[model samples]
Target: MRRFAAAFAAMLATCPGLVHAAQPCLTAAEASSLTAYALPSAITGTAKRCVPNLGTNAFLPTGGAELAARYAVRKHQNWPAAKAAFLKMGAKDESSAFLANMPDPSLQQMLDALIEGMVAQQIPLDRCAEIDRVVGLLAPLPAQNTAELLAVMFGLAGKTGKAKNDLFSICES
Candidate 1:
């Protein structure tokens, strides 16, 4: 029975669902999402996680995710210091180094995730129903050619597809 228990523990260690919360504040998946080519190849796996205090907002930087966003961008220039800065910014304990090594663009995605995560934890994300509306309307348009996307955001008229969905279309005229 003792041997079986030990095997079970070992098995549990490799189980991601169990590890996601029990192991540390951050997850391996979160770590891998960060990629910084500037760092030495060997330092690509050092990261840790942090737990949030309930009923309070902790992750959102004072100026609306600027610190975290900048930290993400810093990977494009320097990463070691940036990682340290991230630590200083209340990231607490980091586990995987993968996040520190991700490129700047990926960091944008990371920041978005972090912001969205904090917001979701703090309030109902459905409050921002417009994002869904935007996605649904924009889905048919070519994302690669962001002219339509930008036009809508900036209230400037641009390209029109064959079937313009008024519910989705942004007419700037």
Candidate 2:
């Protein structure tokens, strides 16, 4: 999970205009929805990008497809709120006009591609083994549980002053 969090934080840091200190925050549910929708693809992309490092027998190379598939089942179900939460994270006044004017389908496509590309690029090869181990540990949990756990951990980080550099905030419940 540390690997996941570190990779996510690195990805967020590279995104321009995401540090909107005063932007409207996502609700806990919205945050969870976004995490649920995005996490599977992130993992899948990481696994694919790290295949050379992970080896054929690594859990990610062997079981990642199944794990990602399990999480994908709820992606459509989570999209609406996830989309809103994603927009909230990215949109920053006139700078985000391009995002605001894009149609939903186009926006979603861009977001999906961006997630895959960013995960593939951000995760360090040196950490692939640790990431593979962490994801394998997480694989036994239900998809929702994994997503919710991540959301809660992020939310707690924001709330407890641990997330000083987080890109966006979670709203108070």
Candidate 3:
């Protein structure tokens, strides 16, 4: 939901001149790969942030940890494609050069931290229960499927004119 959309919007908003760029958008696969790479961080961050409100017995504190670990197992495998999508986000802008030049380790760390921070901040205390339920319901999915599902959701959002901007777009399949 709303938290996911807000986090995505916040990320796109950070890149000035990124919306409606002439640069090509990411394919669904690429978006999925990137999402897989970041999903673990997002889960951990959200769990950490919401644990106070949700309590130690909530889905976030218990099941969420296992879910995050499951996603983390695929992160390294997902990194290459994710990195490409990350850099390509601002490909038509001046920041592209900087992004291209950054060492992979540094870039990886930066993105992980950025994603973790964005999700943690975007989720509100009141929504913790809803998020917990959603995470619980989603826990059955394998990591890749979960990532792909999110990519599709975001792609649909982009199609509806909610996700595309000067800086970001999901390519049409």
Best TM-score among the predictions, by candidate number: 3
Task: Report the C-alpha displacement of residue 94, candidate 3, in angstroms.
Answer: 3.8
Ranking by lDDT: 3, 2, 1
Write one digit per residue (lDDT tens) for candidate 1, span 1-173: 11111222233233233323322221221222222211111111101111221112322212223433333343444433334433222322343344445674675455434433333333223322332233234334332222223323222211334322211122222
Quote the positional error of residue 139 for candidate 1 in Å.
32
Off by over 4 Å in 2: 1-24, 160-165
Candidate 1 lDDT score relative to the true structure: 0.29
Higher-ranked by TM-score: 1 or 2: 2
Which has the better lDDT: candidate 1, or candidate 2?
2
Residue 131 accuracy (lDDT) in model 1: 28
Model 2, 12: alpha-carbon shift in Å? Answer: 5.6
* Per-model TM-score versus the true fold: 0.22, 0.83, 0.85
Sorted on TM-score, best first, the list reads 3, 2, 1
Candidate 2 per-residue lDDT, tens place, 13-118, comes to 5567654666457788987898898887787778877877877898998999899899989988898888777777764766466666778788767666667777
> Which regions of candidate 1 deviate over 4 angstroms?
1-83, 87-94, 124-173
